[model samples]
Target: MKKIAVVAANGRVANKVITEAVSRGFDVTGFGRKENNTKAQHYVQKDLFDLTSEDLKGFDAVVDAFGAWTEETLPQHSTSLKHLCDILSGTDTRLLIVGGAGSLYVNKEHTATVMEGPDFPDAFKPLASAMGKALGELRERKDVKWTYISPAGDFQADGERTGKYLLGGEELTLNDRGESVISYADYAIAMVDEIEKGNHIQQRISVVRA
Candidate 1:
């Protein structure tokens, strides 16, 4: 079985992803800041900043579900990502990030990103900008095996898992209903599929419900 470690495993998306991965028979270890009843093979209580290479040596992949909401904590996005990259710098372990949709381009021409668009909520700009900056730095790293998965515009926490989704490049994806959304459960399917196939390595991909 593949060994997978999910950081921030208690999160809504990460929790569903862990359940999906475990259901598929992957050996998963959930890492969190404190005691958590996560559905995984094992649980580790540690801070993201304190993770070392030796502690994560055998995992096939590490899912980064880290998020920062407040203004002061927003910069932690870049810091946390860089810290993970440093630890897994030379190893073969893949870093699968649950990324923000804000950074996704609004069109194929790459005219403007969602964060740059006028309709984006002002409340979310700081968070999106921070994640975008981290993504920018992530693209510069050639040593680490990373795949950033950006969910659709409406990342519904209460959304259902229909086991179907469409994958796209950097542009935002809109369905026939003119909706850009994907549930945490369905996104997990796409994430695990990428883990199994290893296609689109070192790339940023988006997922929207089919």
Candidate 2:
């Protein structure tokens, strides 16, 4: 991709994504509500909901890193993506999402998701549920060329960047050590790689340390 737009670029994951994408010489623009939170080739102080396809017409891809921190705002996951789908539907611009691992299946049967596992923390259920619903809603749309990538069970914000990762389908992925983890830094590499390669279109994929 020659150009990309990152929503909520000030986020922990998104900031790293911006750095990685820029390092690869892609024209990157960031859109967020907060001004001066992060650096991008171009920064626009716009709400994610305010963005239009017209606003991102020329971008090869747009990354949705929008986060909803509170239980009350959990539905933003679905609504924001729906709004984006509405605008970008039928367009050549691809929509790439930074999703959670909660929805990932725990087995090859694909009947159970990680969020439903007993060891999952009850406190985080609402957020996970919201994200899972968003993914479900996204799946129903055939017009949007969207790719959603869920992180590993342990999505480490300050974890070390190994520059290596393993890719998986619907099931949760584990490394050789049987650990499910990935750093924001390395995940950014996978994200940018997907952007450039245009693989996994209209699919949900997982990435963890190889």
lDDT of each: 0.93, 0.93
Model 2 CA lDDT for position 166: 94
Expressed as tens digits, the lDDT of each residue in 10-99 for candidate 2 is 899999999999999999999999984665789998999999878889999999999996977999999999999999999999999999
lDDT of 1 by residue, 1-210 (tens): 899999988888899889999999999999899788789989999999988998789999999999889988998999999999999999999999999999999877887899999899999898899999999999999999999999999998989889999998899998888889999899999999988988877999999999
Per-model TM-score, in order, reads: 0.98, 0.98
Candidate 2 has its poorest 10 consecutive residues by lDDT at: 32-41
The positional error of residue 157 in candidate 1, measured at the CA in angstroms, is 0.5
Clashing pairs in 2: none
What's the C-alpha lDDT at position 19 in model 2?
90
TM-score of 2: 0.98
Name the regions of candidate 1 deviating beyond 4 angstroms: none
Angstrom error at residue 16, model 2: 0.6
